[model samples]
Target chain A: MSLRNALLAMLTSQPMTGYDVYKNFQTSVGYVWHAPDSQIYPELRRMEQDGLIRGETVPWGKRGTKKRYSITEAGVESFQAWLNAPPEYQRERDPVRLRAAYLEWAKPDASAEFFRAHTAYHAGRIEDWEEMIAALRDQSNPTLAKRIEGKSAEEARRITAYKVFAYEGMIARARAEIAWAEKGLELVEELERRV
Target chain B: MSLRNALLAMLTSQPMTGYDVYKNFQTSVGYVWHAPDSQIYPELRRMEQDGLIRGETVPWGKRGTKKRYSITEAGVESFQAWLNAPPEYQRERDPVRLRAAYLEWAKPDASAEFFRAHTAYHAGRIEDWEEMIAALRDQSNPTLAKRIEGKSAEEARRITAYKVFAYEGMIARARAEIAWAEKGLELVEELERRV
Candidate 1:
């Protein structure tokens, strides 16, 4: 359901070819929500069929045709309804964390390796989030730029600010994960020292 | 696959009926990886079929027969293999964060309400995590006690420490979410003032 809303939300600004939607998803919201093209293409087609969006077979370049999707009024209402709905308990299903829960069964060195990898991974994500924030600030983020193109100055500011806030949340998450991993590494070192 | 390993890990303590597995999953590892009884029951059957576990029909209290499952050598090997495997990127699908990304479409007060509710929700979770950690420290946590039974002092400390580390990571996550939600509230207020 969130995926459907994400697709509709992406089309709120302007009509986009399925390819454009996929590319935008990969670059922008993919950090918050990841969907491969296999899921993205089919979901686009289904949304078109559900009448939440309309697809127009328009000219792609000069010699090709592509079905571009745009949100309908129904889609806007639907997205609003979703946004206003009460939140559900998000089921946690993090595999790395799950593995960490059972790491006592592994060697202490392997446990150290696990946290080292966790630290490095989130460190990379911290960079990704920072880069995204920079992109959003400079109007260099095409996905967001397309979304806010025709809005009033204040409206555009609100739109841009919301996205920036979202990435800031991600940055905080990454930083906390890095800290947790470092603590885990310390725990491993202590265990090895004792064992 | 992780669920299977979790089921196997839970059985490492002693033979547990399917009901026991469900209860343990609800409290202990369930925080890290959620699985409903529907999935749990079927997975248990599959594991028994695969010879990773042996289910014996034992008399429960004086009433009826219940199947209690125990991990075989194969199950132990399989669980260890999963613990040592390389981690994969866990795709994030958080609805609150996704909704936050599109809050510009809502009223400023509505946006503020969203973050406020998020703040409240994770605040409650922070308490839950804190309580769980306290239980772990006091040796009153049954799931952890079972997992560490019949171990040397050093080995038991390692096991207990790993579970604590996992819960600490969860605490870190909840704290980050609270901070993010607070920041989001500030962003909403700032946007409203500017508008």
Candidate 2:
């Protein structure tokens, strides 16, 4: 359901061929709501069937034709409705936390390695999100540039600010995770000393 | 697969009936790896068939009989393998962050409401996790109490410390979320003032 809304949001910027959508998604919306090409292609077809998006046959490279999809008026209304509705929170299902609780079951070296890997993973995510914030600021991102093309200066600022804000939230989360993993590493060492 | 590991973790504390597993899951492992009774029961059957667990017919109240499951040596080995294995991280698909990125498309009030709800939801989770930590500290949580039964003082301390650390990680995440949403609320107001 959220994937459908994500697709609708992507189409709102401009109509794009399926290939273009797949290409552009990686640099833009995929950071927040990831869907592989497999999922994206099927979802686009479903959105078309549901009348939330309209697909047109368009010229591609040379003799090729491709289907380009644009969000419908209904799509805009649906997106707005979803945006306004109360957010549905999923129950916690964190595998890391589950592992953490039972670190007693793991060898000390394995526990330390687990925390190191956790820190490294989240550190990489922080770097990605920080780069995203930079891209949002300078309007170097093609999808963002397209979205703000005809908008007023204030509107463009609002658009850009929201994206930066969203990415910052992701960065905050990654930072928190990294910090927790560091503490976990220290705990593992302390436990080993006692043993 | 993680669900299977979670169930194995539960059984490691003590053997339990299928009903007992479902009942106790809500308070302990359920917080980390949530599964419905529908999933738990079928997985228990599959695990027994796969020799990860052994089930015995136990007399229940009156003329009823119930299946009680105990983790096999294979189950212990499997759980240890999982705990020591490299963790698998899911790609991001956060609905809140996805919505956050497109706040320009939403009404200001709706945007503010979304942030408020996010804050409130995480605040509630923080409370739940904090209580869990307290329960772990006092050995009042039935599962933890059972797990540490007959263990040495040092063993009990290590067990309690790891569980506390896991819940603390959860609280840290919830705190980060609350802080982010608070900033989001402020951003919404700032944007609306310029309108």
Candidate 3:
């Protein structure tokens, strides 16, 4: 359902070929909602079949044709209904956190190695998110710029604000992970010292 | 696989009836891993058939025998292997965050209502987590108490530390959500004022 809604949201910017949608997904929606190309392709087909989106064959090259998609009136209405619907009950699951809760069962340095990797991983995420934030701020982000391409200045600002706020939330999350892992490293050190 | 391993972890404390496992799941391992009872019972059957856990028919005082499950030697081996394995890539999906990213399409008051609800939700989560931390600290938590029931004082403290650390990570996350949502509320207010 979310993938469907995300696809509808993506089409809100403009008509997109499957390739365009997948490419935009990788850089934008995929950051918040991870879906494989396999998933996206099928969902796009389904949305077109459901009449929430309309598609037409377009020339991809001299030898190929591609299906390009655009939102229908129904699509916009569907998206609005979903937005106003109650948020789904989230099931938070983290393999790292789950493993961390049982680390005492493992060899001592197993934890140190894990936390080090955890910290480094989130450090990279922080960098990615910062780049995204900057891109959105400059209106240089491809998918976002398309979404706001012809809107009134105030409308564009509102659109950009919503996305920046989302990425900023992601940045906060990545920072939190880094902080948690660093604290984990400290706890491991303290435990070793006590023993 | 996480659910299977979590089942194995639960059995590290003691053999339990399926009902007991579900009850404990609500309080303990479920903290880090979320699986409903519907998923648990079938997984329990699979684990038993896989010989990772052994279930035995135990006498019920007056009538039918009940099955209680305990981890087998194979289960311990399986758990250790999983702990040493590389962490799986996690794809985080947050519906609220996803919707937030596109809120410009929504009515101003809709976002205000959403963030207000989001703020209240995290506040409750913070309280729930703080209570969990306190229970662990006092050795009054049933799950932790069971896991450390016969361990040496030093071993017990080490085990407790890992879990307490996990819960603290959760607390940090809840606090971050509160912060994010409060900021969201302010953004909505500013946008509404400008309009």
Candidate 4:
């Protein structure tokens, strides 16, 4: 459902061929709600079938034709409804934390490596999200710029602000994770020293 | 697979009936790797079939017999293999952040309500994690006590420390979420005021 809504949101900016959607999604909404090309193609077909989006065959490179998808009024309504509704929270299913709780089962070096990897993963995410926030702030992001085109100054501000806010939230989380993992590294060293 | 590992971790403490596993899970490893009784029961059966755990018929309440599961040596080796391996990182698919990025599409009041719900939900989780941390600190948690029963002082300390560390990570995340949502509420107010 989130993937469907993410596609709908992408289309709200402009109708795009499936390739365009796949390409642009990596640089935009894909930061928040990741869908690989595998999921994106099938979801586009389903959304077209469901009438949330209308598809038309459009010219591609040379003799090629590709299906371009545009959000219908129904798509806009569905996206709005999802936005207005209370977000459903999933229960905690954190695999890292799960392993953290049982680190006694892991060798000391393995435990240290685990936290280092955790830190490295989130540090990379922070870099991606920071790049996104920069793009949103400058209105340089292609998707965002398109979304804000023809909108009033106030409307554009609102749009850009929320997107920036969302990316900031991601940055904050990634930073927290890095901090926790660093502490985990310290804990691993301390535990090994005691042993 | 995580659920299977979580179950194996639980059985490391002692053999238990499926009912006991379901009950104890809600208070212990379930915090990090949540699974409903529906999934737990079937996974236990599968673990038995796969030789990761051994199940025996035990007398139950006078007239009935129930299957109690114990972790086999194979289970411990599998769990250790998982712990020693680098954790797999899932790409970001945060529904809240996705919705946050599009809050401009929502009504002002609805946006406010969304942030409120976000705050309340994580606030509740913070409370749960805090209580768990307290339990772990005092070795008052039944599962922790059982796990450390025959351990040396240093071994017990490692067991307790890792569990505490895990719960603290959860609390840290919940706090970060609450802070983000509070900022979101302020953003909503500021956005609505300009309108």
Q: Which number leads on lDDT?
A: 2
lDDT value, candidate 1, whole model: 0.83
**Candidate 1: residue pairs that collide:** none
Task: Provide the lowest-lDDT 10-residue window in model 2 chain A.
Answer: A186-195
- Specify the highest-TM-score model's number: 2
Q: How far in Å is the alpha carbon of A136 misplaced in model 4? A: 1.6
What's model 2's overall lDDT? 0.92
iRMSD of prediction 3: 1.4
The docking category that best describes candidate 3 is medium
TM-score of the first chain of model 1 = 0.93
Evaluated with DockQ, which candidate comes out highest? 2
Candidate 1, which segments miss by more than 4 Å at Cα?
Answer: A61-63, B61-63
Question: True interface contacts reproduced by each model, as a fraction?
Answer: 0.64, 0.89, 0.64, 0.91
What 10-residue stretch in candidate 1 chain B is worst by lDDT? B85-94
lDDT of 4 by residue, B1-195 (tens): 788899998999999988889888899998888888899899999999999999999888989999999999999999999999999988889999999998888999999999999989988888898999899889889988999999999999989999999988988887888899999999999988853
If the candidates were sorted by their DockQ against the true structure, best first, what order would they fall in? 2, 4, 3, 1
lDDT of 3 by residue, A115-173 (tens): 88887887887788788889999988988888887889987898899888998898887
Q: State the weakest 10-residue window (summed lDDT) of model 1 chain A.
A: A85-94
Error of 4 at B179 (Å): 1.1
Q: What is the C-alpha lDDT of each candidate?
A: 0.83, 0.92, 0.84, 0.91
lDDT of 3: 0.84
User: Cα deviation in Å at residue A125, candidate 2?
Assistant: 0.7
lDDT of 3 at A145: 83
Residue-wise C-alpha lDDT for candidate 3, range B1-195, written one tens digit per residue: 888888888998899988889999878778778888899899999999999999999988988788899999999989988877666667756677789999877877777888888778777767776787788889888988988988999888888898889888887877888799899989988876763
